[model samples]
Target: MAAVTRGSFSVLRQLLSQQYRRRCFRLQNFRSDRTLQPLIFRCDRNLQMFGSRALHTAIVSQGPIVQFKLSDIGEGIMEVTVKEWYVKEGDKVSQFDSICEVQSDKASVTITSRYDGVIKKLYYDVDATALVGKPLVDIETESSSEVIQEEDVVETPAMAREEHTHQEIKGHKTQATPAVRRLAMENNIKLSEVVGTGKDGRILKEDILNYLARQTGAILPPTPFQEIQTPGPAPAPAAAAAATARPVSTPATKPPPTTPKPVFIGKDITEPLKGFSKAMVKTMTAALKIPHFGYCDEVDLSRLVAVRAELRSVAEARGVKLSYMPFFIKAASLGLLQFPILNASVDEGCQNITYKASHNIGLAMDTSQGLLVPNVKNVQLLSVMEIAQELNRLQALGAAGQLGTGELSGGTFTLSNIGSIGGTYTKPVILPPEVAIGALGKIQILPRFDANDQVVRAHIMNVSWSADHRIIDGATMCRFSNLWKEYLENPASMMLDLK
Candidate 1:
């Protein structure tokens, strides 16, 4: 028989007699299962243990703390910079709810929670690089079912006693999300000493903001945390890191370290690279991949200007605004139809030229969030008025930093209106995959010789073209520019090429 040590809780045991058959025993107070407590029993052989205790105490928790790893959001994106956090620590979240927003080199993406649970912890702060496959946040979710293998169910008497022993479990550690911790770290606040008002005394982001408001002499009087707001030794490690980085050594000997200069000697304020600026760096680098050369010339836009003035009233009657850009876009599209090679791309191997069928002209719009070139697709099919309307839409989206999906691509050619912002001319860089890009300068009145012989003040605009030497030669680029100039000089020809 097994050693049946009496427990405080009644035991419903099952036993077998050698002479007879199996029998079952029942006791009072053993009606339902105890949720908070784990079932305990003495180790026995020749018999099995089974009961209503559906969960193991060792693994059973309020919920399982799962480390949410950052998966491949893009094509082999090695890391992503955290933009904003939607959920904080201790906040209950549901499956498919957005947890945070991250920006990669190509685009911005929102991260969603995979499990329904309360946020346990966040590993990285905003603007910090979160590496692929690394934990982004921890979610404590209730696990409905768990599997316990045969080998996993058994344990030694010593092990069973250690886990089953009654003891007080204290959660004195500061419970806060990564964003809250970042705020505290940035403000030099001590999280450990600040009292939390969250579940199980969890420190929330709101608590930190409240603490800051108090420090600024707000209506909320100083709380207990105010007493512990003195500068602590947390910054000592950073100071040590700075000291370690100063010394330099040579193959023979190293120079003795000296007192370092203050970092704030000249600088007043600084900020990290955000998405807008970061995108510029990445795109500009991509733009420089091909060997680019430029062509500069002035075009006679007098005829086109007259045409625009004639149509300006008509555009106004239709509640639409017309500008010189529409004329430029029209002339460029028609010129591209003549010189299709200018609207072509070099294959990946640089062996073949892929001429695009549609003339999607990218108009570079200067925005607060860097240069955005949202193209007007199928420009060859749209009239001058329609081109103006498309430009209006694209410019609006660029200004709002709301360029829609695929609006920035499918561009067979790009035109940068640098002259609109008061530049004589600029050697604009060619956007990737496009063979050539054009620069439109501010229109100015310049003295030029007329058909007879006398110099006359003419409406002239400087045009510069940057072409990829890989495919487009200087001769082809000059010919393309002259064709564009012809359309502008003879505005009637641009209309003739319509449709």
Candidate 2:
């Protein structure tokens, strides 16, 4: 009976195995017919180890290769018309080596290599637009070579090329700050060569200095022109002798009172305004549209002068030189704090007055490019030493004509120091967006009565304030001016509050 029962169980197991095989075969046939939904086999592992490994390998092999996309190239510099190629395919290059000469908007640029590599392929034909950031050529680096597949050709799309071309003509060229481009042009240096030392590697003055130093002996100086002498024809014999004997005397009738003819030339040649000149015109026009009011005041800086000298002595011991600017900046900051409205800007379009919490003071720097105001960001938060350092930096950059767009823009208030130019007093124009500007004049010794009614010589400075009348009333403006004057008269107050 036991043998019979075991035989029945074995038969039942074989029948079950046969049914399972038939089901799998039917599923396969359905999948092959493409008439049934495919089954997704769920993996036992929670994490996809194979996919993770593939991604890790991809990341590792791609290495440091920066495929210049259309964006990497500057705006308005989208498609560069390739003028010349400096290297052939497979040529090895170092960072900053001139790669090609490309023309855009009548100007030509020698684009440089941003990384060290071997040229694998040239993407465009000569005279073609190499859109900014679009790979002009493929670079075969060790790491890139590992990840480079047969299908990974540097493909630039037609739309991308067109976009690059449009950007080159419209945006990039217009957005470049005048100071930076002027420096590049004056030195006959390429903008790409000047590694921006400012925020985000935006080129600054110090970068220009370094570039100039490197290129010093590479460029030849202009040679002076030599004088040329031309021979005159021999004089007629008898007639010339008579003319010479006449003493060439004009009856001193003032030679008929010779009136110079009003010379009318042809059409005057005109160049399209560009760079700082264009920017200045735009800023001034915008500022003039705003309603403005001017207020002038005189401050006795005698006590401040004494305090500055003492502070300078202390600064010298600490290996940092102190300038009058820091004292003035601190004083101005204090005054702004006392009357926050002075640091406010009026949005006439929105009909709103906006008060700023942090004082980002703009310093009007006279650069070769023209008057540029690069702000010292968060001036209120920095110490006097820090302010002096930033002021020095801004001045140095201004002189080198290396200020960036970011530096050139954004300021809650502006300070124009005409004192350096020996000006006693002058009303400065308000920098737009910011409602007010202050001008510092030369400090001079003038006789004035003290609190005790004793007349004595005091070092005094003229303070000129200009504000947008639409934002501030005359009384409020006077109050702001008075606050500044009080701070300058007692600089000790600045030290205490700033500290």
TM-score for every candidate vs. truth? 0.57, 0.54
Over 4 Å off in model 1, which ranges? 1-78, 86-100, 109-123, 130-265, 268-283, 316-319, 452-456
**Candidate 1: tens digits of C-alpha lDDT, residues 1-499:** 1344543222433222422332222322443554334433343422333332434544565765777766654344577788789988999987556688777654455566656788999998988998866788887876543411211222222232221111001111245666877888799875633445786456788888876664443433221100001112356887889977977431223353487786766757788776657767876887898899999999887777777778877765554557788788888998998899999988656898899999999988776556778788788877777777556555644654545334665788999988767787898998878889998888787889999999987888899899999888899888888988888899887667777
Q: Give the whole-model CA lDDT for all candidates, comma-separated.
A: 0.68, 0.65
lDDT of 2 at 367: 66
Error of 2 at 456 (Å): 2.7
Best-matching candidate per lDDT: 1
**Lowest-lDDT window of 10 residues in candidate 1?**
222-231
